[model samples]
Target chain A: MNKKGIIFIVFLILLVLHQDFWNWDNANLVFGFMPVGLFYHACYSLIAALFWGIVMKVAWPTELEEWAEADDSREGG
Target chain B: MSTVIVIAIYLGLLLALALFSKTLFRGTSKDYFVASHSIGPFMLLMSVFGTTMTAFALVGSTGKAFERGIGTYGLMASSSGLIHAACFLLIGIKIWAIGKRYGYVTQIQYFRARFETKAFGYLLFPILVLLVIPYLLIGIIGAGKTIAGVTGAKITPKGTIPGVFPEWTDNGAIPPWFTGLVISAVVLTYIFAGGSRAAAWANTFQTLVFMVMGILAFYLISDRLGGLGAAIEQAKESHKVRTLSSGGEVGTSQLTFLSYMFIPLSVGMFPHLFQHWLTAKSAKSFKLTVVAHPICIAIVWVPCVLIGVWATGIFPSGIPSGAILAKTVGVLVKDPIIVGLVTAGILAAIMSSLDSQFLCLGTMFTNDIVLHNSKKEYTDKQILSMARGFIIAIVIVTYIAALLLYERSVFDLAIWCFSGFAALTPLILAALYWKRATKVGAYSCVIAVFISWITFFTMSGFGGEYFVFGGIVPAAIMWFIGAGAMIIGSLMSRPPSEKTLAKFF
Candidate 1:
């Protein structure tokens, strides 16, 4: 699959994992302090942040920036 | 007194910064409205993140966690991290490119051009203003709540009236409305003088202040409560202030939580956010905002939710959720200087968003309605005066509205505001991606969003935790109503002009 396709799938996976029904009743603690549910979501926030960073690096639309820059240069000269 | 002194100093510094920004103001409407499109990546990141993290994220989140328990973090913060970034990646960058290309300053400008209808903008502008008014209310109300929590008199004054403030507020606090006025004045002073440029500069400074203070408050309170592990254990053991069930199920309202996923869609339509996007130096500037937003949310929210949860153990007798974070710091970290700084930090979180919202309202009024209607070039002085005058007018209106909503929960009030805009996302989404989206279709969506949102708001007595029939969130129904109306309205009516389609696509 192309990078765009992969990005889509990963985003979908992240969305699904965001609804953590499995952890709902677990009532466990993580790292001795945080509630298991809160801990899970904290990690989820980080992972989502990381995923978007990769998406920015890999899948960002350079066409938009290129078009804008090209227009600026054309106007300048 | 020391606490008051500290807050006063912070406000003074902000005023000075706004004056400094005014020194750099180029004498042009474009420069005033979009800062001549010169904001770079780091400032963009700080400004956007700062604007998004209002009192709703800090005091509001902690207060909510105190009432709702641990699941609050997962419900809003985790979901917002991914979804907000998704919005920046998908919608924000697109809008920025268009704004950069076309010199559009308001969303209505883009809509007017995209749909080939001035009438559509006419229908859309008031709805955007209406939705944003409540958003302004959230920050104003939140600032009041935080300050009142810190400064409400310890003992009630004599004969203050039963069931009316002072009597009912003896548990400790001042009025949120009073603080809202003072803070709004400070915000108005800066934005009035400096426009969008000053708002950006202040947001960068204020965002830094609030995030640092949030971490500091977290450490001091947790250390006071015998550290994080002990605090969590004590909260679990107490069970009085906690909303957790015996099984510790995060929440049984699975459907309500699911409905909240739609709330972050509001970001896609926030006029303030649109105005900020227009300030980006490049489409590439969005890369920082997209990547760093979720991490920023985690840094602010996880600590807040945990601190709120710890409050369950600390204030077992019960405390108002609005003041949970403030009260916790007051009791745990007792130095007035520290207290005042923390209060300022919370206000930083609240005020950062207000400046942009205020500026956007002014921008939309001047760019979309005033200038567009007049159809003549206005001088720089005229434009600046118009923007500033309209901003002050709206601030007065929002201040009054915030007073009436003094009793509402900041989180729930914000959700109601967000839900309206969230429902309107289909309008922008279809405008950007759907070639078949006609002006009629956009109108259908906006009108449907306004009507359904009003029905629900009125039913809930103007805004609180409300559900549609069958125990589902109102946003779920409103969102589908909008989508369905838009598709049907478009299919039945004429398509947009091919020229327009070619332009947008």
Candidate 2:
């Protein structure tokens, strides 16, 4: 599979794993402050950010690049 | 009094920003409606971020976390960080290219062109208006509740503020109607003066204020509760499950927990977002929004949700969920200036979203309905005037509705509104990505949404954990039916024109 296809699969995996409600064994605190479940999601958010940034770099369409250049010219950029 | 003064000053600053943008405004309807499609990456990031972070994120999430626990972050914020960016990359940039190419300014305008049917535009206009009114109410009601909570005056032992103005409010907060009017007026002045350009500029400023102040409120409130560790312990003692489920235990049923995920998808169909997307200077402007948006969501939402959870332990007897944030600030943060600043920050989040929404609705009215149907050609000045006039009318109607229906929890009302929009997401996805998606399919999707939305809304008694098949949320049911209708109806009907398909694909 191509890199874009791999990124899509990774996103799917992340989505599936995000349903962590059944992780009841994690009723512990992470730092004496954060709940295990809450801490898990906080980590998930950062990972989500990193993965989406990669998707943008890998999957951004060439057509959109041409479109942006076209618009730039129209705006006298 | 200090809170009211601080909020007033914030409004003044917003209006000043609007006036400043007006000086820079080119005298054209293009600048008014879509900011002449000149917004840059950073400004686009701020505007889109501001427009999405509604009162729901601050007041509603905090209130919900107090009730549900930390799972509130997982249920919405964590997924939102991913889903929102995905939508921007997949949907936003594509539609923006189409819109910029076609000179379309509203979602309805794009649909009307893509489907080659004017009837669909008429059908969509009212539904969009109806959905947006509830959204407007979210901000208006939240502002009212926040202001009332902070400035309603302290309750004496008799449950009344011992003042001559005893009849002013039942809770001794500023009356909801008065608060609604003031908020409506402030948002209206900015939007009216500078249009979308003003809104974009003002939102960038308000977004910064609220984000900074949200962190401050979180830190101060946590410190007041004897640090974050003590706050968690207090919560675990008083409300063991205060992390983030729906009123469920930490082990929220897998199905029920998964359904909340559908709510974040509503952004895919948000008309205001469509208008904001069109304001991009180029497709490149979207990169910042897609990359930085998740982090921004984390910054704003984590603190609000944590504060709400902490409040559960601190106010053990229970506080109204809507008033949790304001009450925490009012009670725990003794410094009057700090209270005012924090309240202003909360209001900034609420109002930032409102201005964009108000401007988008106005743009739709003028572009999709008024101009699309007009037999005579209207001048640029006339078009601008119509959009502005319609916005004032909408602000009045929404303000009155807010005063009448300000009694529900902000969290519940916002969910019902999001559900209605979420059910419509599949239709937009098909419109953008599927060449076979027919006009009939879009119609069926709309019908499915209205039917399922009304049935579930009525069954749920307006709002609350109304599930189907023993676990799925009402929103999930509506979404499935809507998606099914879109796919089936498209297959059964004639495909969209070769012309339309070629244009979009």
Candidate 3:
């Protein structure tokens, strides 16, 4: 798949994970104390950070670079 | 040190930072408004992150989780983690580019130029300000309440009101009116000194202070509660614990949980965030913000949500939800210094956003209203002075509003403000990506949002959980109506000029 396609799929998964349709009220504790649902989101946030990093790398717009350069040159001139 | 003294020292330090930044300011309107677009990557990340996590994330989230359960995390944190970062990646970058390309200092300036109409700017400025004032008020109110709750006299003889305060306040806490004025004045000083540059600097410092202090508060509070394990055990036994059998799925139904996801999308339309994004030195400066904002959100929000949830176990009944965070701290920690630092941390989180919101509104008024209409060529000095003047007026207005609405909870007021802005997200998204978006379409979109927002606000009594047509949030209706208006109204009117199309495309 293309990078854009991969980004879309990852974001879709993130969205699906965000919905609390499963055993969110599960009283089962993770790591001795943390609730399972709460733990799931803690991990989800980490994965989101990683996912956005990938988006920045793959989908970072080149026009922004050009704009920045143009701006720098204008200031310099 | 006493709690009052500690808080005073912290505010003094912040004022010192603000005054220090003023000396660094170059005398220009550009320097005042956007820091001459010279803010670095680290500062951008801090300022953006700080501005986003307000009293809502700290004091309000803790209060909310005390009332609800762990599901509060699922409602805001999980969705906010992804949605806020996604907005930075998609919306922030494009808008930064447009702002840079067109010399735009505010969202109104960008929207006016995008749709090629002055009337759109006139219409938009007020709607954005109306939504943002409530947001500003929430911060002021939250700070006042946090301070009052922490400092409420523990051993009041005969339950008499404190001698300094009016008879109305039976609790010996410092009046909300006093805290509001002090906070408003301190914030106004820095923003007045250096405008956006000072705001960015102060937010960066304040964000760091709050994050470190927040984590410390969490550990200290947990230790005082006799370790994390004991706290959890107590939580399990608490009557506030969520169970599927009792229909208490953490104080929210399945539909309400799902609909709560839409609230974080409000970041996409935040005028303060727009101003922050434009302050970036380069497009690359946003990379840090986009990549790390979710991590920062998780870091700050996790401790707050957990502390609030744990409070349920500690005080199973009778604590007012808004006062739970400070109340928990007051009960758990005995040392005055620790209590003082914790209160400072809460205030830091609250004030960090206030400065940015005040500066953004001032920048908007100066650029879109004052300069846009002025036939006389104003000097940069004049423009800078005008921005500062507008900020002073706004600070006073917000201070008064915070006093009038002191009885409201931070969580509810903040949700109302976020919902109003979130309903207008469709308009912004269309402006950035949709070629056919016309001036008429933007106006119609604004009208649609106003009508839906007012209808829902009246029905919900300004701020409450009111769902429509099978538990869907009122915001979803406003969102769809606004989007539909933009599409249909654009088609009804003439399409945007090819000249405008050529610039964006």
Candidate 4:
């Protein structure tokens, strides 16, 4: 799959994992303090953040940057 | 007294920073409204995140997590983390690109120009203002409530803190209205002098303050209750940890939780956010904002949710949801200076957004309504003065409106405001991507959004959470209503003109 397609699939997976129904009534705590569901989401947020970093690096629209820079150069000239 | 003094000192510092930013103002409407598109990446990240994460993130979520449970994190904060970043990537970047190319400063300006309809501006300006009033109130009311919450406590007899002034604190605290007035004035002073540049500068400073303060509050409060483990242990027995369906006091039904995914889409249509996006110096400026937004939400939210759930054990009863966070920070952290600084952080989170909101309202009124509809031309100075004047006027008016709404929860008020904006996301989504989107289709979408929102908000009795059934949020329903209206209306009408289409595409 293309980069955008992979990003979209990862986005979908994150959305589904966001629900966390499996941990809903687990009554277990991570690190003896954090609830399972809460811990799951805290990890999820980090992963989502890292995923977005990948998107920024790979799937980013570099064309927009080129256009903005070209526009600036034209004005400068 | 020391607490109030510390808060006063913090506000004074913020005012100084914003005033310093005013020195850099280039003296044009463009400069006043969008910093002449000169903001860099880190500042953009701070301003955008700061504007989006308001008292609604801290004050609203802490209180909400108190009433709800740990599931509150999943329902709103986690979902917001992912969804808000998606919005920046999907909507914000596109808007910034188009805004830069077309010199648009307000959402209405973009919509009006894009749809080739004068009526588009007229139609959207009121709805945007109507929705933003509640959002602005979220900041104002939250600041007032938070300061009052932190200040109303004094360590004494009966094992609780009394209000600073016993005779006039309404049996134990400062009133929200007084704090609201002061916060409004503080925000107004900076925005009046410096405009959007001031907001960005102040938000950058305040975001740093609040994040540091948030972690400090988490650490201090946890130490006071023992450790993080001990604190959660204290509340482990309460419904604060369990789902509502699983014998918990709070409702974390699977369906209700899923319904909340629709709420974060509200960012896709925030006017203040759109204005913030336009301040970016380049398309690359959005990279930091898009990538860091989720973790920022997590950083702010996790502690707030944990503290709130912990509050259930710390104070078993007799605390309003809004006051829980403030009261917790104030009571547990006995030192006056610490309490004052922590509360300052809360106010910082709130005021950071208020300046942007007030500026956007001014931008909409001046650019979308007055300048666009009028025949005569005005100089840059005239436009700047008018915007400043209108923002002051809105501050007073919104402050008064806030007085009438002091009884409502920040969480509930914010949800309604967010729902109204979320219902309109279909308009921008279609306008940006759909070639077949016509002016008639835009009107239909707005009409559908307005009607459904009014009905839902009214049926919600103006201040309560009202689900369509027992499980579904009204915003979840209105999204469909809006998208359906847009598609059907567009299909039934002629496509956008080739000229308009070519300009956008």
Candidate 5:
């Protein structure tokens, strides 16, 4: 699988682990103003950004295609 | 003397900057609407951040911290900043790149193009308008209240004697309507004169002033609490520090924690932020702006949190947050002159957000909805005129709403609007990323959002005993189910033409 797939799996594992560690009464363990929680939240954002970057790169159509279409429409008409 | 002069000079400078930027407008729709796409990275970064960091941060967050302790900081303020920064880095860059390629001038325009439907755009526009109007009103009311609170303005009551409206007096108790009108007038003047470009230029000046004042206020307040260590000690002593899941029983459910993530996504889809992306000069600049946005977040959130924590120690029984805010300002400095300066900084925070929001909402209405349907060709001048007219109408409507709803908490109202956007974001994101996302799916998602949000809000209105769910829970479930439906619907139904798909595939 791709780097994004690997990253997604890692994040999924971490999220599940973190959720289990925190639970309802213990939820503060992973969600507080403490250093550990802060670090976790930061990492979560970084992973999210990375995943989004990959999705945009792989899934969306190219800018060149859009330009070419605009050109074609102008000429075909 | 220095404080009064400094504030006066700052106000003068901002107004002058607004007027100077006004010259850039040649009455063209593009020029007034999106600043002719000439915004640089520095200007764009400052404008977007300035517009987002309003009185909500300057006063509301700090006040919340004072009342609820450090949990407000961790759960609401800091999380929002971090998530907002993450959004810019992730989704912001992609939107900027796509917008540039497609000549997309508005968020709804981009949505309509990607989803291939004017109907979707039309449906989305009114929702966007509704979500934004409350935020705009908060800024307006905050500004007016701050001005009245600082200046000791007095006003006549709503149903007072004939021809006798409220006026500023030595005694306190300034009427909310009086303050609202003053703020709306000033904002409308600059907005009418310069449009988005003026708002952008004014935002830069206002942001700098706000940052300096915010940092200074934090330092002074922290010192008053006997430095950082003492402040933290006092906060701990007062039971202000908590794990993230800690809040009033109503605020701390597991679902709420999970649902908080939706806010950052909503920030990504907000129309004003989308307009900021469209105004970028290049993709690289957009990336740089996104990466740097969190730095501003750090500046605002850290100090605000400290002040909030300190307030709890100072008032053990929990001074009502808003009253504590007023008293804290009163105690922080005795001089009226310095109070005036600080007050202006607060007003700047409100205006910075208000002006940009008004400009964006106005542009969306005039350009995307009104002109989208109008057959008669409108000149750029006419479009600009309509945009200005829309700004006035929005300000008036929001101001009236603020007056009617004086008892409601600004922070709660702001969060409610945020929840609306959060509900709307998943479908928008799916349209961008998922090729199979269909118009039917998009419409269904919107329908689900309307249903879920109405149900959640109606239940909340009857009080907590009636409903087991909070706003975010139902909203998130609806989004998830709607997204699934959209994908399945698209698969079962007709897809866009190959020619259209090929343009973005």
Candidate 6:
């Protein structure tokens, strides 16, 4: 499934469980006792951390060759 | 008999672990201070969480909740947790990135390098030392109090020297000096032996002990209150569910919310928390730790809040609102074994936070300020020795401060420490995110925060006796002014060199 589809399913599940569209006080319904607010906060932090990790993983310089090239460019400048 | 033996074994195991880690201590500067920057995710998670939890969470947070009702949870838990997560997301990643790039071991190094001003570093270093020392004293004193209270050991009253160490008392008793001495000895011994690495490893064990105890306390307390449903019912009956309740007029709630927001944001900028971020093995480790932190928070804090609420219903009279819950727990739990375990758990929370704070403050003073400005080059061994020396000095000074100043609440000490960082964080964030931010602006921002926080804190002390407004109002105003000065100063001044901008951005 697409990302949008996954998000939609999660939202629907939360809505059905909570029975209160977006109200914090009434949104205590994930599993038996845990609240949606709690889950939301946890998931938000995890996703943000994961996204940043991906960025750093992809962008960080690799290998001695790359370091030498970057150093040469700096010297030229 | 089994319970007492279990408790004894646990303490022995902790001491053994401290000793075992000591063998790994090569006395090199890096190994002593930051574990040679080889800490893993599990070590990182435990150390950071353990240090942040503190004795304040165990005693002060619950006591405050009992006094102020459910709003205290919002102030201390949900808002604080969310802001901490945000800090990791926004500023923590950047701190790790820059720290690695510059090979910066301490937060002060970052400040010194970024501003390109050793003078600025000199000024900022003392502020950290001054604000953080009182907090260390609170940690030391809190542990002492918990040890005495739990062990049922006799204590001398404040300012009184007993003829000898008195026997255990069942009823009301005096405070203990021996408690302080014992706690100090344990902390100083390991920290002196192994430095930051020892503290970090011990913190991992302590964090586990604290989490289990907190969970157990919740279960026991909830059971005593009949169940979770019954506890909520009692809390509601006691009028403890008022999250938006105001102590005074209309603006009080708004002011309280603003203070909560600002205070939590300051957590990221705290010197010790910064040290934790800088020591991560990889950016990936840092990210994982941040993501996992909320689970730790939930486990640690939710139980404390529940216990606070339960205490409200169980003990409605006799005790004052501020210390009602703690006093109630003292009365209800007559089992010596359980009480001892509870007390140790509380001390674990306090010591875990205190040792981390002491190490961070010492490193900043020794490594960042003193060593940076010295003309003579020193080896890593020399630097490590200086760092350990500073830790001892900080502990001695803070102990003296605690003895001299006797009436400040732990919460007050905590917030005062936070105000210093709260004033500095905005400018730090701007410098990281905004390419146009200049050195001139950064310097002015520091100056503005320094002058404003000091002035407002002083004025509030004088004004609190008569003025209608809370001190937080003036503090909020000062933070904004400082932030504004930084932005405006940058706009008017020469932009930073392209190379400098590229290094950070």
Answer with 3 or 5, whichever has the higher lDDT: 3
Worst 10 residues of 4 chain B by lDDT: B239-248
lDDT of 1 by residue, B330-423 (tens): 7789787999999989889889999999999988988888888885777778988898899999899999988987776545667788888888
Q: After superposition, how far is residue B265 of candidate 5 from its true place, in Å?
A: 1.8
Clashing pairs in 3: none
Q: Cα lDDT for residue B92, model 6?
A: 71
lDDT per residue for candidate 2 within B32-98, as digits (tens), equals: 8888889999999999999998877777788878777777788889989988998898889988887
Candidate 2 residue runs with Cα over 4 Å from true position: A68-77, B156-173, B237-251, B408-411
Best by TM-score: 4
State every prediction's TM-score relative to the real structure: 0.91, 0.93, 0.94, 0.95, 0.83, 0.81
> Which stretches in model 6 have alpha-carbon errors above 4 Å?
A1-77, B1-12, B151-175, B236-240, B243-255, B317-325, B407-410, B462-475
lDDT of 3 by residue, B377-491 (tens): 8877788789889999999888987888787654565677888888899888999889999998899999999999999989988776778886678877788899999999999
Fnat (0 to 1) per candidate = 0.57, 0.50, 0.54, 0.56, 0.02, 0.03
Give the best candidate by lDDT: 4
* 1 against 4, candidate with superior DockQ: 1
After the best TM-score superposition of candidate 2, give how far the Cα of residue A19 lies from its true spot, in angstroms: 1.4
Better of 2 and 5 by lDDT: 2
Q: What are the Cα lDDT values of the candidates? A: 0.82, 0.81, 0.81, 0.84, 0.64, 0.62
Worst 10 residues of 6 chain B by lDDT: B462-471
Q: Return the clash pairs for model 4, or none.
A: B154-B161, B154-B162
lDDT of each residue in B1-505, candidate 5, tens digit only: 3433554576667788898888887676766776766788888888888877878676876776665444454455445544675566556666766665665668877667767788887788888887787788677667656655654532334432221123444344456677687677777888899887888889888888787777877766667667666655655332343333234522233455555555545676678877776666655555445555655766675567557656665665545555555456556554556666666777788888888788888888886878888889887678777888888888888888888766666545576676677777767677667787777777777877777767767866722222235524444565566566667767776777676676555
Interface RMSD of each: 4.6, 4.6, 4.1, 4.3, 6.4, 7.6
Off by over 4 Å in 4: A66-77, B153-155, B158-162, B165-177, B238-242, B245-248, B407-411
**Second chain TM-score, each model:** 0.91, 0.94, 0.94, 0.95, 0.88, 0.88
What are the chain A TM-scores for all the models, listed individually? Answer: 0.81, 0.74, 0.73, 0.81, 0.40, 0.43
Clashing pairs in 5: A61-B504, A61-B505, B154-B168, B154-B169, B155-B166, B156-B166
